[model samples]
Target: MDEENQQAGPSAAAAGPAGRPAKSELVDNQNFEGQFKFGRLVVILSALAFTLFVSFLDQTSVSTALPAIATDLNAFETISWIGTSFLIANTSFQLINGRLSDIFGRRTCLIICMVLLAVGDLMCGFAKFVVPVTVLAGIAVFLVIPQSPTSQGRMRDKVKMIDYPGMFLSLAGVIFLLIPISGGGTTYDWSSPLVISFLVIGAILIIAFIVVQARFARHPTMPFRLFERNSAKILFAHNFISGVVYYTDLYYLPLYYQVILDKSPLTSGVLILPLILGFSLASAAGGFAIARLGRCLPVIRTGYVLWTAGAGGRIAFGPGTSIATIAGCLVVEGVGLGLSMQPVMIALLSNTRKEDRAVVTGLRNFLRTVGGAVGLGIAAAIINNVLLQHLPAGLPRAAASQLSVLLDTLPVEQRGEVVAVYMRGLHCVFDGRAAGDGA
Candidate 1:
């Protein structure tokens, strides 16, 4: 009997007294590492990494291209929508995408997303106007993301599990909210009935979304239980603030270079290299440090401190700021961003249960993208309002609205004055950024 029991081995031994598998044994059974050979594991990881790279590239590439796009299309006032629309879609579909991947296989969802992205890019190249092109691109990003298979139930059952009320409410709320934010004081007056109506409707829809998620949904897209923990709340807030700062800088910095510093679009892109390189290097370094130290809080704290200082430093940027000063400030901000990014995600994952990890991850990304969309809208409103007030009064409405492309057209003497006004607007933006970072 003893020899026969020994022959049964560890798998049988992993059962509890009730003859149920141990929790750890169940987890081990689900481990992808145990199923794949070393070479196969490498290929899987590489493919996933490449997918992530493509998504990130699409997001960041717009920053440098914005100025040129505005100039080419003569749509300076509406250009923010290009980025905002992408983020809005990202924020809206983020959670649903996870649920969708559960219903359809991961491979199927990925193929669809990639097809949309490719088609969207192709249309953008041939696009003659701004708004339509923006819409196309926005629609395209259904979000090129990957999800793991969760083959739990029948297709019909899986489809029924989706939070339809949560999906429509959130999507509608985001669109209504963003329309006013992006257009108020530019396309429409702040006090316009159109703006006020959208704002009120959006708030109501968002509140309704929360209520549905909390009280009604069978499988809530955003589980309220996650926010019950204080740590999760803090991490969510941190990610939101970081996204605001990151996208604000990404979008505005290139405009500053091209408009105030008189640099070409290509040159502006090149100048931002310090920030990008520093971020990449610091992210890698932070990962290694966390692995070595076996903790994340220290790195996170240091990152916030550096980021705050860097944001404050950005306040000094103007027409006369040196390239060296700009580079140094950007480096500091980039390092801070890189250090802060992964650690927070790691902390959130550490705090969450394994089963809830997917939802928590989706929520994190959703909040960040929401922050970015809101930040861009706020920045656009500030700059456009200031420009409306300070731009040369005699300029035509068309020219004034298209000032992003009017630098060359303005008289030599007026160029300096226009640049000065732009700097003032940027100052307000940076001030708000510094305060947000400090908070």
Candidate 2:
């Protein structure tokens, strides 16, 4: 009887490893560790790192080269459009990529994106004309990015439902808003026909997109379910706000260095290294820390304080701030950015099931990018308005326009007086001062 009962007990507890007991395996996370798991983590990190590296290099390296390129190409006015065009195209594509990533896989889409990036780089390196290079670069971006969600594996179940509607809304909203702002200060008159057209089109599309997402799609991309939680909304806002702060810092610091500190263009560009490098490093660190600590809120709060202080602090202190102060600010901001960014990414993932990760990521990225675009325009507007205000009262229109023309002609020193005037005007405009009628 005992022997028979012992054999019967074998099936009593729910199955575990070999039917020992189910609870043991459930309690221990040990089985989850292995080469395969670690390898997947590595691959994800590698992909993300590559994405950041390529994008950063492209943005930063160009500033150093823009002057030289413009001088040789005689496209001073055209140069502004280069950045504007890139932003528009990049934003537009980011929206679509999120949807495509869901249909294809993230890993596959990313590889294609890298290929596009490689081609863009090749064209930029070789092309004499900006048009071909810029257009190709845009196409490359379109091919490379897929707007799918990132998974810390939270919203896994909702994956299949994420696709088009929300993306179109975001794309339209960004395009319309960005066109005017990007052009308002530079490429076209603030009120130019081109700018107006973009604004109008963008607005109409965004409104239509929202309607489509709400009324049409079976599984609309924007996960309204997540927003019902306060934390997710906070996280989204943090990403958006942080981006704005970052863009402002990135745009202005170089101007301050070149204009106020009297550094060369190369020097100005180099001076910004600490901030960008700090951001990249901090992001990696933050991601690691989140995995280890498993405490999301504190890390994010700390990050917020540091980034805000670093960015907004300068607004209060002014140009006389010390180098050490600036460096400290950069490091702190980087830390904050790392802390907030990764955790938010994690939060969105944690909040949802595994499937919805791509959708969440796409939505988050779109908002953050939009915030960045807005920040760029705000910074530009500040500089432009300042220049307009500071313009000396009776400067003859002819001389002023000549000065503007010269400034637009070529790079410093390599460019004749015309280039010099343009550089001076750039400084004057950024510094929030107008050219003296005397000069």
Candidate 3:
């Protein structure tokens, strides 16, 4: 193994209590942090925060916009793809981007990502069609976000070190798995040969990917050794579940407001502010609390309690539900998410060897994003299947397929039934989310 790979390899056999890495095995990179002056560090953090904000906005800004996009393009059935496609691309390339940053320089990669995002955003603004814009944005952001600086390596060595087979397997696996889930009920029947074929192939490839990581890759993108500690396993599980809940809420809540509540897109966006503000404030507070308490479990547990309550509250949503009640539930859910998100990272870093920090961090992100993609797929399937089964018989199949457009054009007398059916689908989604949180 190369020198970098040796350092990044599995921890020594000797273990601390609970199979955790020994303190002596943990390399402290305090000097790296010390390299930055206080003011410089502040500037760097601010810039990074802004980058994250932009990236998140790019991910979520489409939520409130989906209703409008569906109506405008008359493609309500495919609207979910705008978000799912981006996440698919994002999740597939996430770990590879981290490795790339190590090979090239951070600054070089960051600049390229920013430029791609800017270009994608600009093109999206002008595009008349939906698919093209989504494709462009997905490709642009695939390698655009997340990473840290590291020493530049020789081109030949870096190229050889890239886990090409692992990358291909992971990328193809995600694509195959998601395509069927997203399209099964909406675009094709669940038992269709194409969907079945893709699912079987995807599963096989995923198993192969795991085998390659465990037995073949010299510098595995996700080192199995990190899961040695029980804490690490729990933390990763929390991260994945939270991602599912977070993205599901972000994507579906606006649909609830606009479609069921008869709110405009702008009004729905405005209403979602409570969730955003509550999450942001709680995240900040949680970070400080962790620093002060020097513990993460308490906060994580508290957050889960709140999250369950909030998610449970969502199942009560109805045509008669008040705006205040909706907003309150959202705030509680957001705060729960905020409280748990950061501390999980801190907990993971505390347990990990410093050499493996970067890889683990990337893996954390990869799993969360993968969860988001899968969650969205499952959500879409549930909603679409429900709509297919429950949509009013009087409505044409063509019209039923594009409910957003139908709502816009349907007479006042016919709209209520359609809206009620849509509400049922949303209720199912919320119920599943609640069950997930409680579990």
- Over 4 Å off, model 1: 1-30, 74-77, 139-142, 146-149, 395-401
lDDT of 3 by residue, 1-439 (tens): 5785566444434245665444323222223746899999999888877877888777777777876777777667676566666676677777666656655556677788888888888877776667667766765564655553243335665576667888888879978987787667667788999999999999999999999989998666666889999989998998888888787888788778877887887888888888888888888999989889888989888878888898999999999999999999989988987888877888988888765666677778887877777687678778777776887777644322245555867888778877887888888889999999989
Once model 3 is optimally superposed onto the true structure by TM-score, how far is the C-alpha of residue 240 displaced, in angstroms? 2.0
Tens-digit lDDT track of model 2 for 184-280: 7655677778888888887888777778766776556554665777877877886676556555555556545544444566776776777777776
The local distance difference test score of each candidate is 0.75, 0.59, 0.75
Candidate 3: worst 10 consecutive residues by lDDT? 22-31
Name the best candidate (by TM-score).
Answer: 3
Pairs in clash, predicted candidate 3? none
Instruction: Pull out the clashing pairs in model 1.
Output: none
Clashes of 1: 0
Between 2 and 3, whose TM-score is larger? 3
**Model 3, global lDDT:** 0.75
Q: Candidate 1: lDDT of 277?
A: 79
Model 2 — TM-score against the truth?
0.72
